[model samples]
Target: MTSRNPWSRPVGRRSVLVGTALGATALLAGSQLRFAGRSRAEGADPWAGWQPPVQSFPNTFIEQNVPIPMDDGVTIRADVWYPADESGAKVPGRYPVVVTTHCYGKALLGAMADYSRYGYVVVVADSRGTGASEGSFGLLDDREGADAYAIVEWAGTQPFSTGKVGVDGFSYLGATAAKTAATRPPHLAAANFGGAPTDPYRTFITQGGNWSSSSALWFALELLGVAPLPFTLNSYGGLDVQPRNPTTDIATFLTRLQTDGSSIPYRFAELQRLIDGSNNFDNGFWQERTTDVGNIDVPTLVYSGWADLFLRDTPRDFRALPLERGSKLMAIGPWTHYSLPKHIGSRNDQPIDDLLISWFDRWLKGIDNGVDRLDPVLLWENGSERWAGHDDWPVAGTSYDRLHLTGTRSGTSNSLNDGTLTALPAATAGSDTEVIDPLAGVCSRQTVQYLGGLPVYLPIAFFMPEFPISEFPGIDQIAPCFRTDDRANEQGALTWTTAPTGTDLLFTGPVALTLHGSTTAADPVWVARLSDVAPDGTARPIGEGALVASRRALDPARTKYSPDGDVVEPFHIHTHEAVLPVPRDAVETYNVEIWPTSWRVTAGHRLRLTIDGAEFPHLLPNASTPDRLGTLTVHYGPDRQSFLNLPVHQGAFP
Candidate 1:
């Protein structure tokens, strides 16, 4: 049931934060003024990269398998880490608490060793229905948010708590933290999120309004980890059944699994089924799961990468946070979802430990760390490979530049057509068409991102290379590689390229594309990409998007627009009733949302827009049989012109 978008789970299922002090120690010892490459206007140094010496505890101790009762009477599992004296004995002083909940199980988290190793008490809890927690797995259900609220309040009442609590994590765990923050728990003083997006229906579950089973395989993996069958017991160490009742007991664990694993939602199994069929539409169920950032009252920090899967909304959510100015912070790097803040694209030197430590110290401990005076946003200009401070996302002085598709050539890219992309509308009428290759995009960076950079780190290419299809020539090049050129994957793609520019084009926000075209097939699947083609013809990916022709009904209220009333980010209704059928061979206009992104294309680089009728691994185009595999045509002319809107920061160039 999963989309063939490479091989792996969604979000940062692998990157987890544990209670560790060693990491915190590194932060404390790290040089604060190290990011000399950070972009700043003359005399503009708002970022308090200056890390003050954080007072630390001699040691830390964990209370394993702590039973935490939720509001619904079901008890969840947690591991409470407390600051200890030099002798490794627990201390008596009360400290601010950091609470985090995860469906990936508490025991699997790595030693995030930065917070607890300091003076704060950290409580890591397991989401209900996963790990040792009682209740069926809610996969972004409201029940999980309620459970977080209960856990936060409980942590605030502990003997070592200062009555101030902060929620934190990366990916799914971060989403839980955001959900907890939205509940506005009495003890939640601040929150931090990394690659954890609040809007799921349009961005995660059904990307670009094209239904996605992206989580099906991941959910099944979770199901297999904690299933009742003795042979299906977790071998990944992501779950611990004995921890629910005892500290250790293999036989008892198997016995408990056999008796208690028959849940109403069947934990992972039932959740996946619901997502695949009944819960596919955006309705009351998804609305409850989507976190409204406006409801989050505490100070928050948003962290994400340009290539991150959830980049679509993390910045938008930050811009929506109720807190004003520097009360909330955001950092958008040039890395992927697979990378952590500490280990990023290396454009920005500050690690998550450093950022979070200072953040926690400022709000949780009342330190005058100058965090509230720092620029609200910190971005790493991708092409420049440098950090740039900003007032906010969409980068303030950004302008929407429209690039129209034309029949002429730019002679820049080695694309299938090498067609031209200019600012002015085309004078002549022309249309470009290509046969629908449903299995395209197997060798691009999107494949690496979907698989969480697996091929880059492991030998996935050696074992699971791209399958060769007789119908699609050169399909055998699907072998995964790290950050390779896109020209190979651009085969059969209809491209629109611009002449090399005289000045840098700094794009800092969501891109919108208006398409006036039709497909011979009734249900057309469209995939588009924006790339920066270097002088040597290396097409590096900037961002990518996809959509099924039938799901194009827009929701005006949720759709974002510019001052001139142009759609910058279009939100579709995606509900059961909003679905409209496309007539075969009939022309139709559609808004193709190019997912939000931030990057700088050098002066000599040419911008290219590549379109394909099919995408593999990231999206399964044939989600429905008889959906038509006919030719996809893009029309261009004065009346039937299609254009791509880019957010350009005019002030970025010298």
Candidate 2:
């Protein structure tokens, strides 16, 4: 059900008075194409020393302070980027429009003049209440969706528009692109959504039934936007003014936010309301803020980072959007949420921006530049340091390989590196009991950290006052062993590692874990990770998944099964109704779906699986109860076997 104000007309003075009083009530919230070039193999450099063909237009002209009016009479702020000819005159023709909505303010996201150079009229707008736009923010509210629809349509009808429009952005902005596409606006031709999530409640707020504490840091960054600083918007390869809106910058945004009596604490308290599971069920609140990607019918380009926060949903989004046979395209890279700006494809020198521009050119400008003839999927295979092209996302011939969890035969009782993952069942039945400390944080060697157990590079890594290095994604984690090299000796984690492999083992699909376990407490959260253990003993995380024991039921209706109809979806039961407290003393079977991935465990390399009770910062500490600690027992054997289902790509490899 979509949210719309009953009264379509502008809110009268009386309504403003009513709005002020009701302010305390709520807090909210792939396509195919063909390419003509020969399919690039998994390990080839397609873009090395190659540059995208462009019109070579001169400087880009910016039309600042544009106000786009929505149905409810709220005006959203936007900056339109137009192209200039060699003679310094503005290009004189209706051009395809590209719009991006930003939560960090229009100025921060800025207009990518590069697109303008290619004859695209790019518009970047700030979500209402955060920048120059006027209105209360509902955290990606339906109003935002409504505003997006209006803006795209308006851009289409503009004198400078060719009635063709496209949308692009990452994270919050990526989500806005999806929302705009969902409205199925007539002029919406295509979309490029990078690092966006499908379900806001599940992936962003209460992730896997746990609160994302990192959200607080995100909120602080939003607050910091109050003071617009001159910063380089490296992602777009341009210098961007922090606050594009002259009137109400971050300070004004916060001031007006508090003037409504919704103080910072109230805002956080509302977040806590969700964290406390008060609004755990999917209802109008989540719906008002959620975008139905199935509603999006435009050709779409999807971008996902294996090390980013929304890894699981990338493929899910691709499967949802129904586009032309060859219109849906996707590229999965080895990147963190912060490292997406660098055009580097993992270690490859190819600029990701080239692929992006070619995509827009094909869809928005109707230029057949060979991008449509290429394979629909481009996946970065970690460890192999190569990119593979596939006709379908979990390309054909992908088979699930099972690895049974044998007992920890080593001296380290609770170490994750002690156990074994083998193709055969354990010779004998057994069980392992380990204590799960709710307070165990990321620094606690025993846990599987979110986004690959990597050290957080924000605030701390943003600037080294002494050395002052340029901060960017992938820069911090890859800077001289910033993250741990091995977790083999971690104390509290239970791990299972396979013996060295004689042949290269490559996988390109989703991963799942079946665990027969019991916890002493009614509520228990399980963290599972699949990593690669090099012969030298360096353990690098590949993918991870988590589930609050209570939220264990599979919502078959919403879950997608595999093409072979044997495996389960990568995610299940996101609503509160699916949550069920674990039976205190009885062992229960829990199915944990590790996020999808594409990796190659080379010869002599071992695959590892680690399970633990908690990972801080990534998720809020499990519901703590004073000094009480809980014990989790893993039951294995014929009757209660635990194993991992890894998707082995039977397709061609590098």
Candidate 3:
């Protein structure tokens, strides 16, 4: 959560209060006294006061509501900020312009002011229907994309703007940058997206077809805070103070009355109801908002935390863009939702602002900052060393080795065995059954600290290794145990391991499982997580994916897989929603697609896979009935055709 009061220190009044209060009162005391003080303080401008130093470069700053003309002649209002000096200077035809869209929050002028100081024209506009912009905002949908595209074009034509334009921001803003870039706007040149969600349904609204209560609540509250209405005195006093007309500014009034201590939950609940009522993915609403990556044509930089709520969507969108149109760069850091400046292990390295400066220098200024020479994939390695840059993600020269499950009981020695190579039937039938009680669902060992004593929940066992340590310490703490659990009866978790490799294996792209299994429920959702198990028994989660049983038909067009032609389709995994019913006492095996990840598993580190009926918090707890018996069988060997397909690429630079 963002802290509103940045200067409230202990033991005294805030800096702003003490400084401003004393300065004002002292000025009234006597001009002679003030002059004396000023005379003693050499080279200090009395009028400057406590304001921050001016930026080094020539800068122009202004906050104005721009009337952006749309295709239908409907003018959309945008909040624009740019270097003031560029206004009348007839210097060049091209200047780099940065366009940013607000997330759930309305356009914040202060947020974009910093960008203008960096010598670029910055535009922050509310997605149509949001803030002061005309039209209705429909979450992540087409209207927003169109408005973004229009804004990009508008920025390009501005007299002060250089034809070159770039987009940058975090979360909702990040997603907007990507969607707009995909539109292939004429002036669009580059994009940098951080923690952007691509597939909203699968990654944001619902994880594995189940609602995320915490995330949903947070989003709702933010929306309410920014709703375009005003609160009245009667409204604050619990009176029936309805606005005279439908267009009353109730949102503004409500915001004004928000005190230091307010019932945030109450406001959040109101937004939650709006979200809960909408669950259909195929609804025309979501379809209209979704972006078509096929149109994206530019250089792109994507950054996401391994433990980010939108982890899956960030990389998914990056990979979706056609390679021919844009060059893709990905950086997976160890961070949680809000911790930006802090790195893993509590280290405060360079701030995010530094990264942005370097990126802008390369894209906007056309400066050879070595950004073009940098590796396409840059990730932090835990044990071996510090952050490493690779020519391409998931370095080449990796092997696909399988470790079969040979155990029996849920956690007993009988159920535990070394997953070594062995001959098995092509289509064997066996089953293990477990019940998922929603009330007693698995809790994530990690929690995201939020304001007002609220905490974000994560899944317990299903961890992703690629997630950064700082953003998600809880998952990082429990990740190691997920692989080497010799303990007995550890819920319904199933483990499969591979022998340590002798050399580094760079496996990139989506991970898939072609299992043949069936359950009794008509609609069953299965979750799969892949991990890297170190020799010391630490399990690092790398990738995770889920499939709703009924929608088992993989979309052959978007799938990627291992050597044995094991289908690893992306689009078909959760693109469509359908319910598949399981017959009584039936045995079925359905292929499951896990989210894509890129990591180099060094020699002596084991590769692991875990299959569970439920991945709590991250996904909704499965509600499997006792009478419904669900069993999963695996078939391996050259004849049975079991292998993982990885998208391997050689280094772009030597």
Candidate 4:
């Protein structure tokens, strides 16, 4: 539900006069001088009397529905907001323009007004097939990019425009801005992208071919909220447990429900069809939507949240952009999908707004605002509530240290050092194994309030509270982990270790796994989790990575790995999906790549790595079956050295 504004009613002329008087006093006191400036050519500030701060401006909010004609002759409906005084007295030749593309919910009048108050001619348009726009909304498609370009060009020619265009928004809007930048529209000068998904297959919808359960649920809710009339929960079954009435439109609601799994039969039909249609990582679909970061020559500011679902994608975009432009800046904070203006950490509410103003000042007004001289990247590190600027991301001067595992066992004599990564090894033959019951779904740590009775599900909610999965009390009832004091127990889980570091270490980038063992089945799935063990014997989950074995082939163009026979390699596996087989009792090593993360394991914190068969919530439970990875007989040794390889950055910022 949206927040209510008690002061939303129109103010009388007397009230407006009083408000203007107060604003004038503040301007005279030099509080809003930064925003009051004279036109370069005229040498006289047109807005000198309008010295009201952005927050207190007497905005004449007007929402006009206009049919924006695209190149294809398709007209998209846009809700345009401009100062009501535009047609009144003579104003500056033209005003700077900012365009916003709506998310899955389409454009709203209230949201559009919020941007118009910022002193720009704001245009909010419904993507094709959404809201009042023509054509079918096929999620993210080429048509939307084309439409954005058309809108920018149209805005540039309008009488009220200064011919400078800037685009801003999050998620889909962010992606649109990225795509528009790549297109290199003549009028598009700058952009602000937040929580944008760089690679659809790698970051959005599915990661490593595994569909995000939370994302799926969110899309389902969107469908329910937007569908037109007669909202029915009958087909959704238990979904009705939560009631939501967002819109009276039946078509919008039905469209949303059509995206859910419960209506799969009538919506998607064959499971393989849905998967094949969305398996666009290597296909032409994603290729068309993918942005050419190297081609985005315009100034850009990218924002992301540490806790955001699209955190990974935002960083990827920042790293991929061309450095020569020197125009790219990144701002990340501790926040989730919905929380903006306020964050869990850092104090930079004005960073987004200030960045926009400075960007426009330099690009549109040709004023030197020192924006180009700002640091290339700014990130918010957790535990520290301040912003840190760097010449590049993944901070320079990082090094990698391998932690080797060593222990004795109770299970099979697979005691060949098992070469797995770990601070120590198991000591027994019978280690720990947990059978996860899918019926009792795991609870997540992340939650969000919405129009529906239910709360939004987040990935953070499923993190294990303690180390040694066996120690988790909640798992005992649904899934149990095998336990043994024996450090050599190599039956259920694989253990790896690194030598204790005499000095502190900082590492960033992707983590990898190289396994040298065979399983009884042709297809197998394994999971690897990296953690830090404190001297106090407490363990905390730092970073975790997993991959479905069927998709093990590495994309040579994007893969990075160490040359040492250690074999922990990084590969972008989106190019292909291959089936790998293991002969029974045969030692065949498999190199696995995990997700990326940044961390500094202090001198006293032992870098502990855990190799397990499953990770609940984050990943689906690995049910051992003849059809799956087959009966597994795992082994590890230095000759077949299986370890975690980390990318260490080093060097000073320019």
The number of the candidate with the highest lDDT is 1
Error of 2 at 640 (Å): 1.0
Candidate 2 per-residue C-alpha lDDT over 113-220 given as tens digits, one digit per residue, 9 for 90 to 100: 268878898888877666667666667788888888899999999999999999887777788888889998899998888878657777666556777654544555
Better of 1 and 2 by lDDT: 1
Q: What C-alpha lDDT do the candidate models reach, one value each?
A: 0.68, 0.66, 0.50, 0.49
Clashes of 2: 24
Q: What's the distance in Å from true for residue 218, model 1? A: 3.3
Error of 3 at 485 (Å): 9.1
CA displacement after TM-score superposition, residue 17 of candidate 3 (Å): 76
Measured by TM-score, how close is model 3 to the native structure?
A: 0.68
Residues 495-585 of candidate 4: C-alpha lDDT, one tens digit per residue: 4444344555545445566654455555455556555545554444444555555556665445532222233334555544444444454
Superposition error at 7 for model 2 (Å) = 43
Better of 1 and 4 by lDDT: 1
Model 1: runs farther than 4 Å from truth? 1-49, 52-55, 110-113, 212-214, 220-278, 340-347, 457-482, 625-628, 651-654
Tens digits of lDDT, candidate 1, 1-654: 000111112223222222113223433564111111223472344454545436577666667668887767877877787787888788878999998887665665622335776788888887777666676667778889889999999998988899999898877777888899999999889898887858877666667665543444345445532432221111111222322334322332354466675433355454554444456678887888899988999999888877666777787788789798768998877666655324322324445566776778889998887777677887766777666677766565555656889999877666567788887778889988888877788767677565444444345337644422222321222334334578876778799988887887777777888887788886877788888889999888777887778888887766765433445677788788998888876778788888777677888888889998766766743335257378888888988878887776542221
* Global CA lDDT computed for model 2: 0.66
Error of 2 at 195 (Å): 0.6
lDDT of 2 at 343: 53
Each candidate: how many clashes?
A: 7, 24, 46, 61
lDDT of 3: 0.50
- Per-residue lDDT for 496 in model 3? 54
